[model samples]
Target: MPSRADPLWRHRPPALLWGLAALAVAVLLALNLGALGAVYRRAGPAAAVFGPADWAALRFTLLQATLSALISVALAIPVARALARRRFAGRRALVVLTGAPFILPTLVAVSGLLAVFGRGGLANQALGWAGLPTVSIYGLQGVLLAHVFFNLPLATRLILQGWSRVPAEHLRLAASLGFGRRAMWRHIEGPMLTRVVPGALAVVFLICLTSFAVALTLGGGPRATTLELAIYQAFLFDFDLGRAALLALVQAGLGIAALLALAGFTLPGMAMTGLDRDAPAAPGGMARLLDGIAIALVAAFLLLPLAMIVLRGAPHLAGLPASVWMATLQSLKVAALSVVLLAVFTAALALAAVWSRRAAPLLEGVGMSALVASPMVIGTGLFIMAFPFIAPARLALPVTALVNAAMALPFALRAVLPALHRAEADYARLSASLGLGVGAHLRLVLWPRLRRPAGFALGLGAALSMGDLGVIVLFAQTGGETLPMQLQRLMGAYRTQDAAGAALLLLVLSLAAFTLLERLIGGKEPRHAGT
Candidate 1:
C-alpha cells in the first residue's frame, strides 16, 4: 500500500510526464487551430465555399465514413468472438496478423486489394473463370471496402477485449443461473458492447473521415473527395495553398470536435490503445455452423490478400535501383530518431501526468482527442505550417521524425503510464526518502522496476514511426521515398509488380527492424527488457 505523506506530487514522475505530454498536445492543437485562421484567410468567407459542391463533398464524406464505420463494426463481431473464445492452431499468429492492417502502409493494402479485387484483379479473374459478372471496385463503395479492411481488425480487437473483460465470475454466475448463450450474452456481452460499440463506431468513423490515399486511389469520381484528398489537390495539383489551407483548417476543426466528443466516451477504462491482450477463457462449442463459417471467412479476409502481398512481390525487387537500399537505410534512420524523440517526449509528459492531477487528465484528454486527427490531417497541417520557413521538406527527415514521434505520443503514454503508476504506487515513499536524482534514479530504480513497459513503449513508438504515413506524405518527394511512399507511387503509376515488391520489402524490413530494436534494447538491459 502507498504510504501517507506521499503528497501526491511529492515524487510523482508519471503524472509529471503526462502533464508535459498534455502540454505538447495542447501546443499541437494551437498550431492546428491556427490553421483555421489560414483557412478563413485563404478561402474568402465560409459562405463562398459552402456552396453546392462543398455541400456535396460534405454529404459524400459523411456517407462514406458512416458506411465504412458500420461495415467495420458489423464485420468485427464474429471475428472478435471467435478470437475471444477459440484457441486453435496458429490462433495467436492470426490475431497478430489482424493487427497488421493498423500499421501496414495504405498503399500496400490498396495494392493488395487491387491485386485481389481490381479490374485485372484476382477476384475479377476468378469471376471470369466461373462465368460470373466481375464487380467494379471504383467508387464510394470501394473506399468503404478499404476502410473496412483496415478497421475491422481493430474493432474486432476492441470488442473481443470487451468480451474478455466480462469477468469469469460473471460467467460462472451466469452458468449457475442456467443462462444459455443468449441469456449470457443478454446479461454480460450485450452490456459490454453497448458500452464498447459507440466508441468503436465513432473512432472508425473518424479514421475513415480523414483518409487520403484510399479515397484518392479508389474514390473514382468527384463524388468522393475527402477533406485530406481535397487538401492534397489544392496544394499539390493546383498550387492553391489558400484553398488548401482553408480546407485543412476545416479538417482540423472537424477532427478535434469529433475526437474530443469520442474521447469523452472512452477516457476511463477504455484502454483501446491497440494492444491485443489475450482473451480470458470463454467456452464455445461447434453448436452453430454459421459461427464456424464466419470465423473461416474472417480468417480468409484477413489472410488471403496479405499472402498475395508476399507472393506477388517477392521476385520483382531484384531489379530496383540502389536508391531503394538507400531508402531502407533512411527509413531506419528516421525510425531511430523518431523513437528517441518519442521516448523523451512521452517520458517527460508521463512524469507530468503522475505529478500533477490536472496534468494527467489533460494529457489523457489530448491523447484521446488525437484519434480525430489522422496522420494525414496532422501531416498536412504540419507541412503547411512548416513550409514557408522550411523549404524542401524532403530533406527535413529530422523534422519529419519529430512530428511522427509526436504523433505516436499518445500510444507511448498509454503503454507507459499504467506501468509507471503501478511503480509509483509500489515505491513512492521509498524513493522520496532515497532522494535519487534523474540519472541515478533511472539507472537504479525506475529502469529495473519498469523495464518491460519502457521497452514496449520504445518498441511501440519505433514501430508506429516506422509505419507512419503522415510525415512521409507531407515531407517526401519523388527523389526520396520511404518504402511505404515508394509503394504508393508505384501503385499510383500502375507498376503493381514493383509496388508488390516494395510492400514485401517494407513488411520484412519493418518487422525485422522492430524485432532487432526490441532485441538490442533487451540485450542492453539484460534483466527486465521485454520481447
Candidate 2:
C-alpha cells in the first residue's frame, strides 16, 4: 500500500542498523550483567544478613525518594498551571532557564544551597535578625530541599507540556460555554493531570533512588544514609564486598521497581516548544496576581542559590590552588571522552530503533537499561573485576567517562530518534533513488538533519560528566581527581574560599561546555532532552 506520496524504498529493517543494535546491546549486557555477576560471586553469607543500619538505610532511601517526588510534583502543579495560563515579557527565557538545574552539577548546587540555607547563610542571617530560630540545611530536610530544587522545574516542564497539548479549540469551546474554573478543571485539566502527573512522579522518583552525590553531601550521618551511600560506606570503611554487593543488589532492585512503575506511560521528552503562548481563556484580576506571585517565587527559588555561588566564587577565582586547576584539566578530558562515547552509542542505538520496527522496543530498552543499575553498583563491579588485572585508580578517568556515557545514553537516544525518523521519512527514498551509499547519505542528509539534536545530546553529556562526583570518589587516588572531587576535597578540608571558587569554576565550565558544544554544532537554537 505504498501511496504516491510515500517513498519507494523497500520496507525492511536495514542490516547495518541491526548489526549496530546487536553490538550496542552486547556491550550494555556485558557491562551491567558482568558487573552484577562479579558482585554476586564476591558476596558471602554476610550478604543475606540485613542489620539494623541496613534496614534504616533502606527506609531512609524510600522515604526521601517518595517525599521528593510528591513535593516536587505538588509544587510544580501550580507553577506549571501559572506558566501555561499567563504570558509576560521574558516568559520564554524563564521557561528555558527552568532546564538549568538538569545540567547543574550536583555538588555545586549543594554548595549554593549551603550558601543560602546553611547556619551562617542568608536564611539563618535573616532569621537571626528577626529573632527566629535558624534552620539546618543538613539531614533529611536538606536532602528534600536539594531534590525539590532539582526536580520541581522538571516536573513543572512536564506538566506544562500537558497543558500545551490541550487544544486551543477546546479552550475556546469552554469559554463560549461559560465553563467556570472548577468546571474547567473537572472537564479538561483534571484528565490531563491524571495522564501526565504519574509519569513525572515516576521519573523523578527513579532519579532520586540512585542519588549518591546529594546524599553524600547532605546526609548528616548513618541516620540519613541512602542505599547508595550505604554501599559506599560498606565498601570503603568495612572493605566488605559481601555487604557492598548486597546493598548494590538492593539499590538495583529499588531502581527496577521504579522503572516498572514507569511502564505503560509514555516517557516525556524535555523539548521546550509550544509552551510560550498565552492561554486562550486566561483569567484576570486575582488569578493574574496569583500567577505573578507563583512565577516570582519559583524564579527566586531557582536563581538565588546560583547567584550566591557566583558572588561567593568570584572573589576567590584568582586564588585557587594548582590542584584545582589540574582537576579542571582532568574533568575536561573526561567530559570530552564521555561526549565522544555518547555520540557513538546514542547514534547506533537510535538508528537501529528507527530503521528496525521489529526490534525498536528491544533497542530502546537496552539504551535505557542503565537506569536499572546505579552508578555505584556499576563502579563497584568494575572495581572488583579489574582488581585482579590492574589498579582501579589508574583506570579512573576512562571508567568515569564510560560510566557517564552509559548513564547519558537514554537521554541522548530520546533526542536523536525523532530526528532520525524524520530524516528517514522525508529523504530515505530519495537517497536510495540516488544510489548513494551509507557514507554519502549520512554526510549529505543525516548529518545535517541530526546535527542539532546530536550536539545538544553531546553537550548535555559533557556538562553532566564535567560535574560528576560519583564513581570518581571510589576510584580516585592521590592525584586522580576531577573538578567535583577537588571541590569535595576543598569543602572537606574546610577551605571555604577555595571551595566556593572551585564550585564557581565548575559551574562556569559546565555551562560553557553545554553552550559551546550545543551552539557550535546545533546552531542557533537547541532543544533539550530529559533523563
Candidate 3:
C-alpha cells in the first residue's frame, strides 16, 4: 500500500487496450443480445407458445441433468478418495489420465461407448453366453451412460482438488486420538465433502443440461428429447421459427436457472491453510483392498470403451469414404480458425482486464457471457440475421468457429489473466528500469510467461472446435460437412464400420491438435546447470 510506483498504481490505460476490450464486448453483445433480438422478432404472437411436447422436453432436460450430476458425483467420491489416500506405482499417470475425458471429443467418446455396449457389442455377447437377457442402449439408459462416462472424470478431479487442500495435520490428530473411519469421516472428510460436492454437482448439471450431441445420438425419440433437440426439431425439421425462438428462450431460462442455483455453493477454488507434510495413513488391510478395487474398477470403466474403439476401428480405417475425408479437412480448418480467434479475443480481454481497472469487471463478464447462452440460441440468431443478406450455409464454418471461440473465451481468459498478472508482478520494475518499449516487453518478458497458459487454452479451443456437432448440425449442407456431422451421417446411414473408423480418426485428430499446439507454442523451458 505504501509503494508509489506499484504496477497496480498505474491508472491510465492505453487507448488501444480500451479499443480491444470494447471490441471484445461488442462481439459478445452481438452474439448474445443480437441473437436474442432476432429470436424475439421472429417469435410470432401466440404461435411461439410452449406446448406439451416442449414441456416434456423441459422435464426430461432437468431430470437427466440432475440424475447425471448425482450419479457422477456419487461414483467420483470413492475414486477421488482412493486417489487421495493411496500411493501406488503409476498413480501420477492415473491422475493425469483423468483429464482426458474433459478435452476428448464428445462424439468420439460416444462412439467408443457404443462400440462396447451396442446391440452386437462385447457386453451383449457376454450376456448371451451367460444365458441372460441383453440390454438395450437406445433410450434414457444410453444417455445416462454417456453422461456418466464424460462427467465422472470431471467430478473426480474437482473432488480430488478438495482432498489436496485438506490439512495433513488434521489426519495426524485424528490418528493420535485413534479415531475410527466413521469418526474420521464425521469430523474431517465429511465436512470437506459438504463444501466440494455442491459445486461439482452444479457444474456437471449445467454441462449435462446443455448437452446436444449426446442426446441427439443416444436419446432423440419423442419420450427422450431434450430442450436442445426440441429446438433443433422446431427450427430445422418443422421450419417453425416461432417455436424455435420460443424454445431458445426456454433454453436460456434453464441455463439462467442453473446458474442461479450454482451461486449458493462454495466453489472448489477456495483455499484452506494446510501443513506442508504427507497425510497420515489409516491402517487396515481391508481399507487398502477397497481402495485398490475402487481404482481398478474406475480405470477399467474409463479405458475399456476407448480400447474397444481402437480394436473395432483399426481395420476399417483404410476403407473410409471420400466424404469423410472432406469432412475431416473441414474440421481441421474450423479448429485452426477457432484457435486463432480464441487467442486474439482472449489476449485482448486479458490484457484489458489487467491494465485497466475500470473496465475489468465488465470485460470479465463479457468473456464469460457464453455460459448463459446456448450454442443453438446463438446459431439461431445468427441464422436469422444472415438469412436476409447471406446464405446460412456459406457462413457455416466461420460462424461455428466464432461461436466456438466465444464459448471457449472464458476458459482461455481464466488461464491467461493470472499468467499476465504474474508476469507484470515479476517484471514490471525491471522492464521499466531497462526502458523497454511495449513490444519489447511483450516479446522478452510477457511472452515466455503467457506462452504455457495461452497454448493450453488454444489447444483446448482447437479440440472443442474439432469435435463440435452442435451448430454445424444446424448449418451444414450436404457437401459442407465437418467431421462430427459426417460421423453422425455415417451412423444414420447404418454404416457402423465407417462410423467407427471416422470416430477413431476424429479422436486422433482431437488429441493430436491439443498436444501439438500445446507443445509447439508452449515450448519447453531449458534447465540450468549447477542446480
Candidate 4:
C-alpha cells in the first residue's frame, strides 16, 4: 500500500514520523516496566505468587471473563443476523445506539445499570407488584450482567459488520441452491461466525480479564475482585509496588499469550469477510418469533440503563443552576481539546501503521498500558513519580488529554489506518505529481480519500475523551471537571439528583457529538467483503 507521494512513496520525506513518535511515547511510558526489576524487596520469593487470596482473585477473574465472553458472543449472533437482514425503520438508529456504551463512562454506566437491575431497580419494583423476590445486583453475576449490558451491542456491531459483508455472489449462490433458513446459515452465516467469533471473544475477554471499573462498582466482595482491582488494592490499600509490579507482570503475560494465540488466525483478508452483505429471505412465524425474542433481549440489555439515566435525570432538569451550566461548558472545552489531542495522536498511530512492520505490536502494547494500571493506578503512580519535581494536577487537562488519546489509539488505528493504506495504494502517483504539503494534502487529498475513516477515528477519540476517567480522576482536583469527573463527584457526594441531571446532559452531548463527527468524517466504506 505504499505510494509515490506518501512517505512510503519513495518520492518523499519519511512517512515514518508517526512510527518515530509512537516509539518515543512507548519508550517514555515503558519506564514503568523498570519498577518490576527493583528487587521485589518483600515479595518473599518468586514462587509466592500462589497466595490463596491472589489465586482466588485470578481464578474468579478468569471465570468471570470466560463466562462473560461466551454469553456476549452467543447472544450477539442472532442479534447480528437480524440487524444485517432486516431493514425496518429505526434499524439504523438501533445500530448506532449499539455504539452508545463506547461513549458512556464505565462509572456512569455502572450507575445506570444499578438503576435498572439493582435491588431497588425497575424490574424489582414491577415484579414486587407480582410478589416476586428482589434480585441482588452485586457479585459475579452482577459483573457479567453489566458486561453483557456494555459489550453485547459492540459485539453485535463487530459481527454485524461481518454479517453484512457476505458477498452478493454468495447470495446468488444461496438462491440458486434453493437455500432455506437452515441452509443459508450453514453456507453463509457459519462462515461469518467463524470469522467474527474469535476477535469478538478475545476483545471481550481482554476487557473482562482486566476489568476494574465493573468489578470495583459491582463486584460485591473480595472473592470477586479482578486482577485490575487487585492491582488497585495492592497499590492504594497496601502501598506495595513490589506486589503491584508482580501482578502487572502476571496480567501482561496472560494477556500477551492470549493475544498471540489469536493473532495466528486473523488476517486482513479474513477481517473483511462477513461484511460481504446480502438481502436475506423473509421468515415465517417461527423465525419472526425468534427474531422478536432476540431483538428484545438484546435491546433490553442495551437500552434499560440509558432509559434509567433519562428517567433519573429528568426530574432535576427544572432546578439546575448557573454553576452547572458553567461545568457543562468546561466539559465541552475538555471534549473539544480531548478530540484534538486524540486526532493528532491517532493520526500518528495510523501513520505509524502504514510505515512499519513493527507498528502493530508497539501500538498494541501501548494501547493496553491503560489496562495494566488503570486510572487510579496510573494517575496515582504518575502523581507519586512527579511529586518531587512537578505538580501532576497542574498539568491535569494536558495529562487527561494525553492519557485519553493514548487509550483511544487502538480504536483510531483500526478506523483510519486501513483506509489510509488503501488510499495510498490507489492514488500515490497522482498525489506525488501534485506536490502537496502535509496540511494541504490533508485538506484536499487525504481528507476526501479518508473522510469516513477520519470521522470514525475522530468520533471515537472525542467520545472516549468525553467519557474519560483515567487522568481526570487524579488531575482535576482543580476547580474544573470533565463530564465524567463531574458525574463521579456528584455520585461521591450523593447528590444523585444533580448527577442524574448531569449524566443525562452528558449522555446526549457525547453521543450526539460522536455521531456528528462520524457522519462528517465518514466516507464510503466497502459495501461487501469481496468488494
What TM-score goes with each of the models?
Answer: 0.84, 0.91, 0.91, 0.86
Clashing pairs for model 3 are none
lDDT of 3 by residue, 373-403 (tens): 7788789889888989988999999999999
Across 238-298, the per-residue lDDT of candidate 2 in tens digits comes to 8777777778778878887887887756445433233333446588899889989988999
Q: Looking at model 3, how many pairs of residues clash?
A: 0
Q: What order do you get sorting by TM-score, best first?
A: 2, 3, 4, 1
Off by over 4 Å in 2: 1-16, 44-47, 265-281, 419-449, 526-531
- For 1-531, candidate 1 gives per-residue lDDT tens digits of 545535334444544454556567765565445544444454455433444655666677778888998999999987777666666788778777777776666666777788789888888999999999999888887898889888998788778878776655566667677787799678777767878887788878877887877887898878877777776766667756566665655666776776766767754563333233333355556634566787888878767778888888889878766666767777778888988877777776677666667657766666544555545444555565566777746545876687667666766676688877877677766665676555565577666656666676677667666665655776777666676666666767877666678777887766665556656664454453321
Q: What is the C-alpha lDDT of each candidate?
A: 0.70, 0.86, 0.84, 0.71
Runs off by more than 4 Å, candidate 1: 1-31, 34-48, 263-291, 374-390, 426-457, 471-474, 517-531
Each prediction's RMSD over C-alphas, in Å, is: 4.8, 3.9, 3.1, 4.1
What's the best-to-worst order under lDDT?
A: 2, 3, 4, 1
Worst 10 residues of 2 by lDDT: 269-278
Per-residue lDDT of 320 in model 4:
67
Instruction: Give per-candidate clash totals.
Output: 25, 0, 0, 17
Is 1 or 2 the stronger prediction by TM-score?
2
Number of the predicted model whose lDDT against the real structure is largest: 2
TM-score preference between candidates 1 and 3, better one: 3
